[model samples]
Target chain A: MASSIHDLARHLNISIGTVSRALNGRADVNADTRQRVLEAARTLNYSPNQSGRSLRQGATHSIAFMLQPHPGDQQYGEPFFIPFLIGLQAKLAESGLDLIVVMGAPGDYQQERLRRVVETRRADAVVLAWTRREDERIDYLTQAGFPFATLGRSRSGAKSYPSLDLDFEKAGADAVDRLVARGHRRIAAIRPSLNLNFAYLFLDGYRKALRRHGIEVDPELIASGFINEAGGYEVTPHVMRSKDPPTAIIFNNDAMALGGCKALAEMGIRPGHDMAVTVIVDTPLCRYFSPALTAFRPALEPMGQRLAEMLLASIPAFAGPQGPRIMREVWPLELVARDSD
Target chain B: MASSIHDLARHLNISIGTVSRALNGRADVNADTRQRVLEAARTLNYSPNQSGRSLRQGATHSIAFMLQPHPGDQQYGEPFFIPFLIGLQAKLAESGLDLIVVMGAPGDYQQERLRRVVETRRADAVVLAWTRREDERIDYLTQAGFPFATLGRSRSGAKSYPSLDLDFEKAGADAVDRLVARGHRRIAAIRPSLNLNFAYLFLDGYRKALRRHGIEVDPELIASGFINEAGGYEVTPHVMRSKDPPTAIIFNNDAMALGGCKALAEMGIRPGHDMAVTVIVDTPLCRYFSPALTAFRPALEPMGQRLAEMLLASIPAFAGPQGPRIMREVWPLELVARDSD
Candidate 1:
């Protein structure tokens, strides 16, 4: 594990800087060279000393995943983050990169912790998950010259950065199409916070799907913001109270759906039979819920793999000619049929 | 954020080495000195450079959580870790220690990962969660002289380390008493793999509870096993096939119970009516499951906080006089009664 870059370069027939660069994911190196360097390092048991390597290449072979836990985290039963974490860790484990989950203190969250992680050079790269549409972390990471990848897309629309996201737009449209096919015309949708880029995509999918069915997008029918349990719980009551309440409701996640169900039960409504409910991100618990929840399951492992690969390839000191490329890998959710709409 | 140890020492009227020792969690520094040193550093916005400081003090203000992705992790719906993480993270955030989750690759689980994490100095302290009867990780961590803590107890009889565990024995005994009170003389229990230290504790609890009722221990009624959904699925049938099947059953977790329920339903058994069922570790999904699951619910926040506090205190650099102490905290689970029991 102490084998140096010199030994690695000598064994691989490459220059020391190239070895260091390849190890660090630098763009100047090429893909094949980086591969050889990595293979050689592994064969020789050369896990770099993070301290010394950081001084030379500004790399720590570690990435931090930051999360902001609101009250809704528990209400939703912590569904999204766990699978997402499993996917990310599974991919990064192959490259011997460690993942640090940085949870903020009461007052500070992602942006604050990110600054600490980057400014202190604690990691070779940073991964931003669940990005807001105008994410401050994206801008900070970019301006700070740290290689980063977001599980969600940035609003900047830069082609240089790496990002991997779910095909929410397709899932949203498919959900609407499925519900519409079931003879439900008045369909309503719930979305994540409007500030989140994915929420925009979710809304876009809903609009596009409705348009495909020759229905005009109704602003009143869409409930956005913190689309968590509280969000679902709060929004459903309003939707049900509307003069023309929709018979069918689409939820972004099972938590929201669960919350919505509670609201429905309060109003003497049976979710699947009286008011159709469909959700995205089918958690395992959804199967146990009364009127088993029907949801669209995204390919989490692939998404996590793509993000890890992009982040690994983007490290400036270790990247090859196949340098950090702006990659957008989106997997559409597969519908998992259950008792619920 | 980049204030060096020298600047901190100068500002706080301390020696450079003292400042370094204080920041690095060294035991040599007195409690008062360490406190003053930490306060001054914070006031001056001194965020230590992990690389340089690590070279000098052999420490990194970070901790790693190792996870083995067993099939049961997904089946249990991963209810425990998330809340545990929230608790751990919330506490550690105050001390500015980051939590690194190390997911083991297929073949090499904990022991191998610990060697690398410690040898590489990736973390100043390594946290071993879910201990076994004679945990290899615990021995290694102790031998390596690396500051460490565990989320479970060790069987070594030597309480030299910090641990915070749930009172599984109490939970198990409680389940038995509750079932016995419900007029069930024949009871069955599904335990975790006996190799796990907690499993033994869980079994002990079950035995003690039965003894409380003056019932002789029935070896055939206790299932020592790989107690996941599959284990439950496979074991329940055998129990039922026995010449004298148990009228009441206790499960280690919701996952195993859910599996047992499936096995029961397959045999046209009506749980909670035909046979009583009780489980530990109540999860959010259990509520929606038909005939809501009755299980023991531990206060996860307190458990996590204890672990984080212990790990934080164990750090050699920042630990004050009230420094890292070997403490054991065991919280009894609060029973949530439901239809299942």
Candidate 2:
């Protein structure tokens, strides 16, 4: 938010470069002039864009990770990002790239923060996480031709972008198949909010699995909310209290599943025995849960490493891509079957 | 990372200001020179420091948050940082200070990473979170006379620095008092690794409370670990199997408490019924725990806000301090009693 270096220079009645040298305290600048420049800078409240100066020389040697809340969700306690970030940074460090995290508020959703960063050229290559289906950010980045990558894929028309995401549809189908094999007729499902593209994609696979087994889809059995502990707690009772309560449940994440277990315990219901439960994405804490969770553990560190590699490779100087290499990666889900399902 | 623009100017047979002007793409610079300068910069792989140019001006208008793994502990899933960071960034935003997060690895512990940042002048003022006692970073920053703040207080001598931390010792005593009042004769405590100042401070309060209650402190009842869910699971069984088992348990954090409860559940032990449980901090998930946890809630957002405020106020230009104003704050913890303990 530097008003203008030109204005500061004009006020000092000096050439812009002399003003720069004076403010920068370069050996060539006079000491008295440097002091005058500092006083003027303080008076003007001068603040230069750090990245602007770096980008002028062609590279910043830094990867920008702009952290933003997922649209329509203020899910605060999802412990996924930190480990993912740590992994990404470790990978980047080998190439002498620093990872600078720029955080954004819920109000600054939809790549509005990223747009500013790109304009300022704060980082050479930007990395976006938790992509949505039909993401506008993906479209904007592709159109602008900015070097960037995402942890999840976006449904953009024919434009190739570097991205990595889970094969959630397959994971969803696998979960349903496993629950059905356990002799469960009535099944309940808790999905992430419908706004996220993954939620619907997951449900689509779930529906196909039910169809394969010739089970009619029951609209009453489906519940949707934020995929956290509270979401599971609230949805469990509604689904269980239905006219035909399901004997089995599938949670979108371990957080919701854990919450479901607590709800079941409160109602004197035993999971895996009274009500079969399955969760996607196993967390370390899940192992300590009673009636141990049947879930999928996505290799986060590897994913992070892969994402960084893909992003680095996509940079024109790195791999010398031909007409923008897609660098697509859809990781398969790994199942860890515990007693819960 | 930038291999010097001065060398580039000498190599190109141009004045330093001309190289700067050309690299920055000022209108006065010739187009041919700008192209030649860009090609040379690419060949040299010169990456300018974003803050270096600003740092010369006496301020970067940036506040750095160096994210490091707590020493001797690779605790990854502490959901505290994101919310705490969000709050700090929000507070800093009002003062026109951009938050730059520089993450560090366990191997780069001590003040190694921070030393590099300081040498680079990456930020005007730095913020350290989750500080340890006898912290080398604190000592170095204090000795260097750098502007900085800590989320937790350090055990440094009379020379004070800006800091805000939870009064864990008081919370530990309060927890013991509550459990003792609930007719628990033998109570257990799970502290963070003794290497951390908090563990001993909390234990100090615990011992004081037990003594106040006229009960003998059983050394076997006190345990320590990484302070995550796994820590609680590992220590719960050992303490429960002791000759004089504890009727009540006070876990350092909710994650450990949840794990402790799970450990009990595995052994057919019901928390609040068979073993009273109290956690030091209340997490959102604690509300759903059956025989719910009694915990102390440290207002984190406000704490972040306060830390930022204190750090900002300590900046000499902002507050015109006589010397370095050593702002210190020890936040009061609020008790949230549920079914457990």
For candidate 1, write residues B1-341 as lDDT tens digits. 35678898888887899988888799999999999998997788777677876665556767777765554454333446667777787777678677766665433546676777876778767777778888878777777677778887878536778888889889988989989988998999887677777778888999988888899888778775444556677777767766788999888877677677877876778777898888887775455455667888878877888888877666647678766667777888999998877
Poorly placed runs, candidate 2 (over 4 Å): A1-56, A70-75, A320-324, B1-56, B70-75, B320-324
Query: Which 10-residue span in candidate 2 chain A carries the lowest summed lDDT?
Result: A69-78
Candidate 2 lDDT tens digits, A1-341: 33467888999898889888887668998888889888988897575444445545566678888787543334345476767777888898888677888877666563766765665456788888766777777787777677888887678634466888888889889989988997887888887776566677778888889989999889888888666677777788888878998999888777777677788888999987888888877776566677678887787877878888888887876664463356888898899998887
List where candidate 1 sits over 4 angstroms from the true fold.
A1-49, A74-87, A93-96, A156-159, A186-192, A214-247, A259-276, A288-292, B1-48, B71-77, B215-248, B258-276, B287-292, B312-318, B322-324
What is the C-alpha local distance difference test score of each model?
0.75, 0.77
Report RMSD (Å) for each prediction in the order shown: 6.8, 10.5
Q: C-alpha displacement of A110 in model 2, angstroms?
A: 5.2
- Supply candidate 1's per-residue lDDT for B289: 50
Identify the candidate with maximal TM-score.
2
**What TM-score does each of the candidates earn?**
0.79, 0.82
Instruction: List the TM values for chain B, per candidate.
Output: 0.83, 0.81
| Tens digit per residue, CA lDDT, model 1, A1-341 | 35677898788777898998888788998999889888888788777666775655556777787766654555223446666666787788777677766655433446777887877878777777777788777787777667788888778635567888888888888989999999988888887677767767877898898999998777667775455656667787877766788888888867677667767876888877898889877775466455667888876766777788887777755567766556676767899988887
